[model samples]
Target: MRKELYVYHEGKPVQAVIRTYTERDFDGLIEVQRVSFPPPFPEELWWSKEQLTEHVVRFPEGALCAEVNGVLIGSMTGLIVSDEAVEEAHSWSAITDDGYIRNHDSTGHTLYVVDICVVPEFRKTGIGKWLMQTMYETVVQLKLNRLLGGGRMPGYHLHAGEATPEEYLERVLRGEWNDPVISFLLRCGRVPVGISEQYLEDEQSLNYAVLMEWRNPFNSSSL
Candidate 1:
């Protein structure tokens, strides 16, 4: 694993530590998720710190974190998935078993990118991008078959009053409009498959999400 990462602040590069999650990182990752995800859902929908720990406990290799000067700032979590459910339409709660990571399957080849988050203070920095790239690298390195990267369309909230999820995704893909989250995800090689309603109760996206598939060509060629 790579140990050093650099992110920018006000156009200046700063050093950051990138590593896998340790038991001590539990509280920090939960805190990051809380601040990163803006909401429209009830308080009951939130994942408590203990719940987050369970994910790391079940699949430590699937979870990663970034820290700068010893302060935790970003994280990405995922779980292995297989069976017909991987191709069929599924909501975030369904895949995560309502946020418990109970669906994690080590025998599976598909890595379900459940969450990628960076604290607000670190926004606009390249840390989010790096975290994503790291996950992409992971998919390739692990020789996984594909990545089900569920990306939030936070910018969708701003335009939800004007268009449907399909319309918005079409516009974004066609270069007619831009969505901060989904748009970038596509650029990172995540291709939209469809939309999942109630996937997340994210106020920014109105409980809607764009499902994307990224296949690892290298893994297939060697098979």
Candidate 2:
């Protein structure tokens, strides 16, 4: 809700202060992302604190970060898109598979989760779940309709060109998927809707990825 809020687990008490991302937090966010991801995205792609501030000045509350002891440990980035925009993106073959494109026109709002990362040491301590709960609270407060992202097989290992979609699905269905991060999201609320075959193919890195959706439970009227 605010920077003053603290999430407690065990006796240690994790003081997670969430706020809108600023230029000053970019470097710290980048560091957190690098440590949290296996093949971290390039740091250069993130805008400087100044640029981010400018960007947020126009689109306020677009990005958020969680910090403990003044150090950023996790962050979530998302964008508000229209149903038309979603349809347009789906129209492109290289973007996503048709099975993954749900009918969002009936939905009121669409908040696409671009990224959500937490440092390894702080995970499984209830911090990740707290952060997600906080996100749901924030989304409801902001009147957003849904939360969406991609789920990966946690801790999954790729053996060169030997990987296959069927093997990945089998692993996930069998509950052998190893990626802790993705598993954490799944446990929190994200549901597997479809496979992100294009993303996996373009990256040439992972064997499987799934599109996930987390609808706003507060929307009683829609339900």
Candidate 3:
């Protein structure tokens, strides 16, 4: 196991280890997505096996998985993109481009985290934090300036009929409300940069997302 990426869940050491994905982990990736993310977002929202396989081929290092007892329990998928790309509004499918990931620009200075899923059983075990920290480490390794993503506001579903995203965010920041995705990102030190409408088909986020960023505070170049 990689001590650098160790984690704990539910009063026990998380019997999982994080690593870049390999060809064999594809099925586990699908299973994690299905089991971790609950319904109503439409099955189309999930990554197809072909798409995930191609992504692993294109940017192996950007696709990470947490294996527990040899079963894949978590996944974090990302694509390298230019700073300009992230500045624009993008849907999950648009950024991923039907799983082709056509926008993985080598010259880009940002890593766009397209998806991060952990099985329901593994939720709240610090697994998400470990995955995010690993993402930070990846940015430094790749010499990128930051990590950028359009993250779901899972708590928005309940308030979408009454609250504007702006109002909702205010509540989240005030601690008057709690959003699983937003709160997790907050724990990872990611800052909300903007509001993106129609970001994903997720009912939880009301099809909206928050543009977030985590700048590398310890890039090797700085040292």
Candidate 4:
């Protein structure tokens, strides 16, 4: 599915396209992750050739990229998981098979988002939201139960010493605080379902992630 939208580019708006990822997009995708998650974010955790290859080959529809003027600026990756798997709290690595998506099950009922990122310069221009909406569309098209993901609490470390993760999340839900990740998830139509510890290795989030979900309105089973 090719989706077109306008995004800020060099201080002006430019047309951008969102479409399924391809083999040639690997390098561009890596660059986007590099700038999006800079140093201290574990450079080794960035997208790898083998893992990206697996994404398109295994579940092409789940791997999407956004391009502006021939340059990839953002992307979202996903894998299908069963209801039983979604009910269990799982780490990003475990759920996505260490990013290779080796466990992707076409018959699974849920679309599990593994990662979503946009280049720092291109953010706040609706690119991230568009990528998310595209994934939501995928859930509808596949007639899946829902879209599920573990959202990083990048802003939680600041409140970690004063409040528990749950407490901090409460404040965020009540609009007392705006977590960079949680707030964005809420804006994208996802609701917090629970918390997952050791969800990722990111030091910024202190290995904590909020479990978020967006149920498909068109799916009767989800209703």
Candidate 5:
């Protein structure tokens, strides 16, 4: 069954219906990805509507989409990679010269966040947070303890040895990195573990992605 999600900002409610992806939704998802990313992946890489429907039918929980007014504004897809699967892949690599898969499994689960994207015009309005919160809720419901993915943090190092924090704030306000989103995640207790040195090549930019584990304050075990 498909789930529904909603988020409110300053008393104005925004509806985000969470459901399995369809072919029609792929186009909108592609548009969102293109606008949100630099050197967007080729459109040909995306599955068609029929292919999306077929894939979802086979793996319903692996695909999810968020739509507002029947239009997809954002989406996220993930899979739980098990340690056994990782080991099997490694064994096969010995027969062939393929690269080894780095499988980091904790609590018997490794969440692979394939992608998460939000449209530009509707950004900074809590849509991204809502989508993530919804994802977390779903994870918890499935009895998972951790969520892993890449997120953008402020480019504080860009002004290395030159600008102060105040100057960095100015650059941030001028539509630099999405600082508020990073702040929200930090406030939610997400911690940074590492970064990708060459996450982006076209813009000569790198992504400071961190692996954040969800901690429940009220749970004694979590503390």
Candidate 6:
């Protein structure tokens, strides 16, 4: 699928194309991660050629990237997973097969999003939402039960001294607090199913993650 979007870059609107990434886009994808997640975010967590290759070969439809003038600026990756994987508390590495996504189940009922990133400059340009909308369409087209993703509590570390992760989550749910990642997911129409400990190595989240899910409205089973 291909979509054309007018996104703001440097205060000027530029056309961007969203499409399923190919093997040739690996370098661009890697570059996006490098710029999107920096410092505290581990460099080792960036996408690798092997992982990108596996994504294209195993589930190309779930791997998408946005480009402007042939330069990639954002990407979102997902792998099909069974309900059992969604029900259980699994770390990012486990569900995504340590980034290789070898555990992708073609018969699975859920589309488990692994990662999403937009370069700092291009953020808030509606690129992320457009990417998510594309995946939502994929879920409906494939008749998947829901869209699931683990969200980091990037703002939790700041409130760690005042509240435990659980308490912080409650506050966020109650609208008394806003967590960068969790709040973003909530705004995207996902609800928190639960929390996963050590879901990722994110320092800002204190290694904790919120299980975010957006059920497919057209799927009765999802309801």
Of candidate 1, the 10-residue stretch with the lowest lDDT total is 38-47
lDDT over C-alpha atoms for residue 97 of model 4: 96
Give the Cα-based TM-score of candidate 2 against the true structure. 0.71
Q: Once model 1 is optimally superposed onto the true structure by TM-score, how far is the C-alpha of residue 157 displaced, in angstroms?
A: 4.2
What C-alpha lDDT does candidate 1 achieve relative to the native structure?
0.80
In candidate 1, position 47 carries an lDDT of 52
lDDT of 1 at 26: 79
Residue 91 lDDT (model 5): 22
The clash number for model 6 is: 0
Candidate lDDT scores, in order, read 0.80, 0.59, 0.80, 0.92, 0.52, 0.90
Model 6 residue 198 distance off true place after TM-score fit, in angstroms: 1.3
User: TM-score winner among the candidates?
Assistant: 4
Ranking by TM-score: 4, 6, 3, 1, 2, 5
| Residue-by-residue lDDT tens digits, candidate 4, 1-223 | 7988887767788999999999988999999999898877788999999999999999999999999889999999999999888777789889999999999999999999998999888888889999999999999999998999999999998999998999999999999999989999999999999999999987779999999999999988997
Write out the backbone clash pairs for model 3.
Answer: none
Tens digit of lDDT per residue, candidate 1, span 67-97? 9988889888888888566677778878977
RMSD, one per candidate, in order: 2.5, 5.7, 2.5, 1.2, 7.2, 1.5
Error of 6 at 124 (Å): 1.5
Could you arrange the candidates by lDDT from highest to lowest?
A: 4, 6, 3, 1, 2, 5
lDDT of each residue in 109-145, candidate 3, tens digit only: 8888978888888888888888888888888888888
Q: Which digits, one per residue and each the tens of the lDDT, describe model 5 over residues 68-155?
A: 8887777766555553543331221221111111332334454445555677766666676666666666566656545554444445
Q: Put down candidate 2 lDDT per residue, 1-223, tens digits, no spaces.
A: 2655666646677667877777677789778867875455555544345544543453345467888889888876555556455543232223222212232232437666555677887766666676666667666776776766666553445532454655665565567764454567678887766665445432433545666677777876424
Error of 5 at 105 (Å): 9.8
Name the runs in model 3 displaced over 4 angstroms: 1-6, 38-41, 219-223
**Cα-based TM-score, every candidate:** 0.88, 0.71, 0.89, 0.96, 0.62, 0.94
Q: Which ten residues in a row have the lowest lDDT in candidate 2?
A: 95-104
As for candidate 4, its clashing pairs are none
Give candidate 6 misplaced runs (Cα > 4 Å): 9-12
**Per-candidate total of colliding backbone pairs:** 0, 5, 0, 0, 1, 0
Q: Per the 3 Å backbone cut-off, how many clashing residue pairs does candidate 2 have? A: 5
